[model samples]
Structure formats: structure tokens, C-alpha cells
Target: MTALSERFTTARQEGRTTGRTAAVRARVLAYVGLTKPRIIELLLVTTVPAMMLAARGWPSFSLLLATLVGGTLAAGAANVFNCYFDRDIDRLMQRTQKRPLVTGEVTPRAALVFGFVLTVSSIALLAATTTLLAAALAAAAIFYYAVLYTMVFKRHTRRSTEWGGVPGAAPVLIGWAAVTGSLDWPAVVVFAVVFCWQMPHFWALALRFKDDYARADVPMLPVVTTALSVGRQSVAWAWATVAVSLLLWPVATGYGIGLGYTIPAILLGGWFVVEAHRLLARIKRGGDMKPMQLFHVSISYLALLMVAIVVDAIV
Candidate 1:
């Protein structure tokens, strides 16, 4: 009986230890989830291309590494703050209902503090390893995304996506500044490409999740207007994005953005424009709009275009 009791006690202790270990792991993952890693990946898509273009090829290894890491942290900080502030709305949207804050996996206070730490660390890292302008741009982007877009524009206006694109495009400028220590026409053109590209890209997403936005009382374009109107706006922005992308070759004459980028840019932009028009046509036909089709295509379009930029800059 003494041996049996000791064995039972030991088993219970091991079980408790295992339970604690599992809980700790979950908490750690919850914090990571608050940072929105997928968005950080897209930020990299634009950032690396701009850095390459600005450097006219690969920048120094240390500068590239530092800029990418700092940019990732900055994007993470902005996302965490967005999650903290938008927890209420997120709880209402089914797609976001499983997010860390919404699911109570992370507390708002802890997420807020994490965001601050990330913001400071990212800025410090950038300033130490790259230009001050790069660090400054990162700070401004975080502020714009977290405070202006999340707290104000997103909640109140149908044009939120348009205005919000400013911070979204900041990665281009930030990457260029990291290499060149200043912004220039090339940076501005790439910035405009991303800025104009976001309208159609995000409007397509908004259309797919219109009910979610409406349920949350957010004023996303699709939530505030007809699908037809949103489709028209998307087509307009799609062409605008292509036009701005074309302007990059002229602005970056010495940067080797020649036939390689131009041909692919034209082809890719044509595909994006066609998809946007297809969405509009579907809406007009009173058929299934299938908005996510354009959303997915927009992802491909930007990624491929950025790849073209990379190839052109290197070759």
C-alpha cells in the first residue's frame, strides 16, 4: 500500500507538470499569432524588391538582414496593436473570431505592451544597422497603421482602404531609404504602385467579407456600397496600379528596370486588370460575383510583379 501511494503521487505530479508545459506553449503561440505573420510575408514581398532596386542589385548582407528583420518586427508591432484595438470588431467577424485576442488567448494589456516593445526594438535595430530615415519610416508606418488606419479611418470611412494604403506602401520607401538613405522618384513610383494596387486588392477582399464588415459596423467599401460600384472602383484602381508600375522604368533609368520588368509588368498587369473586369462583368450579369477570385489574383499579381522587379534590378 505504501508503494502504491508513492507511485500514484508521482504520476499525479508528472501529469501536473505536463499540463503546465502545454499551457505555456499555448500562451507563447498565442502571442505569436497576434503579430499576423502572413501580412509580414507580403510586406517582405515589396520590401526586398525595393531594396534591390535602390541598390541596383543585392545590398550588403548585413544591411539586407537588418532591414528585413527590423521591417518584420515593425510590421509585427503594427499588427499586434491592430489586433488589440480591433478585438471587439474581430469578435463579431467570423473570420477573425479565432484570433488570439478575440479568443482570449492573449490579454489586451499584454498585447499592447508587446506591441510597444516590438516597435521600440524594431526602430532601435533599424537605426543601429541602417539609416535613420529607415528607422523613422518604420515608426511612421506603425503609427499610421495602428492609430490612423485602425482607430480612425477603418472605423469611420468607406475610403479607409485608399487612405490606409499609405502605410501599406511605406515598406517600399523604407526599403529604399535603408539602401540609399533618402527617398527619390524611384521610391515614389514603387510606392504609388503598391498604393494604387491595394485599392482593387483590398476591395476584392472586402467584397468577399462584406457581411463580416457590416456585422462589425466597419465602413469597408463593399460594406458601404453596391458590389457593382465596388467592382467599378476596383477596375479603375487596377489600371492605375499598372500605370504607376510602368512609370517606375522611366523614374529608374539608371537602375536597369528594362524589358525584363516591362514585359512581365505589362503581362501581369493585364491579367490583374482582366480579373478586375471579370468581377465587374459578373456583377453586371447578376450572377455569382466570386469576388475572392480577384482577391487571389491580386496576390499573384503583386508577388509576380515584385519578382520581376527583383530580376530586372539584378540583371
Candidate 2:
């Protein structure tokens, strides 16, 4: 009958509408994935604490929100640029094989255009909402990450990750500068903490992915060096990360961090160092070190340290 035909047509149109909606949602998620949200999240974790320490308490909500949003976009832009530049190699790495560029979910030309748009927008947002210095630091961090590290160090040297820690540590400085409008010794000390922490944090991750690096012809330390060498280096930097973090206790004297910060620093820092040594010991015994365990713990270590900073500063 005519009624049955109309019902069939309505159902078909509804199905088409649902399909289009789903496609649009997937496209949006693909664009978001290109930003590497996880890394940006970790960077932001360290940022607010640095801002709190610099202010000796909570900063204005508007300023805090602005700094966080700008930092996210800046880091997102840098990550997008890295994806564009590393697209070819990314397709070869097992971990990166599913990335937007690799799977053709996003085109290279579109990715580059997106990166450019993010670059302009992030810088302009920072400059408008925060200080010029904050904006400049964000720009410098982007270039340091996408250019110096991605293009130069990553290609030629085994020590690339170590040398490339600056951009990873930059959010701390950027956040402090946003609050104080200048850099100080405390900022430098915090920067060193993040820089030192990065070596062990990433080396553990690199150990698990070294095979992928080798497949891609990248010169990561784990790819070029022996496991024993990697373990020894990780241990040394782990201890150095702990020492540098403790040094912040004294340098942050006027910033209101005290026993509250000190307790967590000693406990968490010592635990991280112990975990690093555990990896070294396991390697010496010719056993699997479960590098990913350290990798996961490292994330917790830095996040808790920043939490302690926030609590200590506000109280």
C-alpha cells in the first residue's frame, strides 16, 4: 500500500541522517587525536602548580583558565606539527601506526594547514589573555619541539630525548612567567626538575619501544645503546631528578612550600629512584625489568609532586 511505501522511505532517510551524524563525530575525534591529548594533559598537569607556586596561592580563575587553554593549544599545535613532520616514520612505528596521517583519516595538506592555524591561534590567545613573555615562551617551545627536536636531534643523535627535554619542561616556565611576568631561580629549579625527570621517564618508555625506533631508523638512545647502558643512564638521571626536585624545597622558600611539599618530595622522589634502581638491578640480573611499570609510576610521581606543590602553596 501507499502507507507502507512512505514508512519505508522515512526509515531510509532516518538511517542516512544517523550515518551522517556518526561520520561527523568520528571526523571530530580524528582531528582531536592529531593533537595528542594525553601529552598535552601531562604538560598542563605541571603548569597549574607552577602558576600556584609563583603566585604563592591560587591565581585568578580567569588567568588560570587562560593560561591552561593557551598552553593546551600551544602544545596541541606543536604535536600537530610533529605529526606532520614525522608522518612517514610514524607509519612505520607500531605505536604510531594508527595515527590520523598513517590511517588516512587526515590528509597531510590538511594536517599542515591545521597546524598553521593552531600556531597562530595559540600564540594570539596567549598574548591576548596572558603576558607577551608567556606568548613568546609558547612560540619558542613549539619551535624547539617541532623543529630542533623533531628535525635535528631526533634524526641524528642517540641523545635526542635527553636534549629534547626542554620543550617538555617548558610548560612549568610558561605558567610561572604568566603569573610573575618574569623568570626566577625557583622557575629555573622547577625547569631543571622536569628536564631531569624527562630522561628517565622517557628512557623507560623508549626501552619498550626501542624496537619500533630501530624499525623506523630513528636514533633514540634505547635503539642505539645496549639495555645495560640504558639502565645505567636511567638510574643516574633518576637520582639527579630526585636531587633537583629536593633542591626546589629550599629555593621555593618564600613561595610557601614547606613540610607539606617536603614530605611528598622525599617520599615520592625516593620511591621513583628506588623504582629506577629496581630496573637497573633487574637488567643486571638479565631479567625483564618491566620498563612499563616504571613508565606508569613516573607519570604518578610527577603528578603527585605537582599536587603537593599546589597544596603546600595554597595552605
Candidate 3:
């Protein structure tokens, strides 16, 4: 009987230990989720290629590491604040209902404090390891996204996503500044390209989530406008995005970007526009536009375009 009781006690202790470990792991993941790491990945995708183009090849290892780390932290900070501010709307949206804050996995106060810490750390990291100009751009991006876009325009304007592209494109400039220590025409052109790209990319996503936006009272274009109208605007922005991408071919001459970049830019831009027009055509036929089609392709377009830039610079 004594031996049996000791066995039972040991089993209980092991179960309690396992439960505690699982709880700690859940909390850690919840905190990481608040940072919105996937968005940080997309932002960094633009950063490294810009750095490569700015260097005309691979930049110094230390500089690349510093820029990427700083950019990720800065972008993460902005996203955390956005999540905190939008937690209410997020709870309403089916897509965001599982977010850490909405799920109660992380407290609002904890998320807010985490955002502030990331903001300060990212800025200091950038300033210490890269040029002050790069640090300033990172700070600007954090402020623009967390304050301007989230707090003000997102709730008020139908064009919130459009204007929000400014900060979205800032990583390109920040990456360029990190490498060159100053802004230049290539950086500006890349910025413009990203700015134009955001419209179709995000508008497509907004279209996909129109019902959610409406439920949440967010004034996204798709929520406020007809599907056809959204498709038309996406097509128009797709044209502008392609046009701006082509402009990089001419502007990037001094940076060793030539036919290598130009050819892929034209091809990819054409494919992107074709997809945008497809959405418009679908909408006109009174069929479901399947905006996620364009949304996914846009990610590919941007990734390929950046890769072309890197290849052109290196070759």
C-alpha cells in the first residue's frame, strides 16, 4: 500500500510539471504572436534586396545583420501597437479573432508595454549598428504605422490603406540608407514601386475581408465601395505599380541594373496587371472575384521583382 501511494504521488507530480511547461510555452508563443512576425518577414523581404541593390552586391555581413534585425524589431513594434489598438475590431473580424489579444492569450496592458519596449530597443539598435539616418527612417516607419495609419486614418478615411503604404515602403529606404548612409534616386524609385504595389495587394485583401471590415466598421475601400469599383481601382493601381516598376529599369542604370532587371520587371509587372484585370472581369460578370488570387500573386510579384534587382546588381 505504501509503494502504491508513492507511485501515485510521483505520477501526479509529473503531470503537474508537464502542465506548467505547456503553460509557459503557450505564453511565450502568445507574446511572439503579438509582434506579428509574418508581416515582419514580408517587410524584411523588401529590405535585404534594397540593401543588395544599394551595395551593388552583397553588403558587409555585419551591416546586413544589423539592418535586418533592426528593421524586424521596428516593424514588429509597429504591428504590436496596431494589434493593441485594433483589438476591439480584431475581436469582431473572423480573420483576426484568433489573434493573441483577441483570444485573451496576452493582456492589452502587456501588449502595450511590449510594443513600447520594442520601439525603444529597435531605434537604439539601429542607431548603434547602422547609420543614424537608417535609425531615423525606422523610427518614422514605426510612428507612421502605429500612430498615423492606425490611430487616425484607418478609422476615418476610405483611403487609409493607400496612404498607409508610405510607411510600408519605408523599409526599402531604411535598408538603402543603412547601406549608403543617405537616400538616393534608386531608394526613392524603389519606395515608389512599393507604394504603388501596396494598393492592389492590400485592396485585394480588403476585398476578401470586406464583410469583416463592414462588421468592424472599418472604412476599407472594399467595405465602402462596390466590388466592381474595388476591382477597377485595383486595376488602375496595378497599372501604376507596373509603370513605377519599369521606371526603376532606367533609374537603376548606374547601380548595374540592366536588361537583367528590366526584362523580369516587365514580365512580372505584366503578369501582375493581367491578374488584376482578371479580378475586374470576374466582378463584372457578377461572379465572385476571388480577390485572394491577386493577393497571393502580388506577394510573388514583389518577391520576384526584388530578386531580379539583386541578381542584376550582382551580375
| Most lDDT-accurate candidate | 1
Model 3, stretches more than 4 Å misplaced? Answer: 1-3
Residue 107, model 1: lDDT of 87
Q: Please give, for residues 2-70, the per-residue lDDT of candidate 2 as tens digits.
A: 999999999999999999999999988888999999999999999999999999999999999999999
lDDT of 3 by residue, 76-168 (tens): 999999999999899999999999999999999999999999999999999999999999999999999999999899999999988899999
Name the candidate, 1 or 3, with the larger lDDT value.
1
Give the true-structure RMSD of model 3. Answer: 1.1
Badly placed stretches (over 4 Å) of model 1 are 1-14
What is candidate 1's lDDT per residue for 103-150, written digit by digit as tens?
889989999999999999999999999999999999999999999999
TM-score of each: 0.96, 0.98, 0.97
Better of 1 and 3 by TM-score: 3
Candidate 2 Cα errors over 4 Å, as ranges? none
| Candidates by lDDT, descending order | 1, 3, 2
Q: Which lDDT values do the candidates have, in the order given?
A: 0.95, 0.93, 0.93
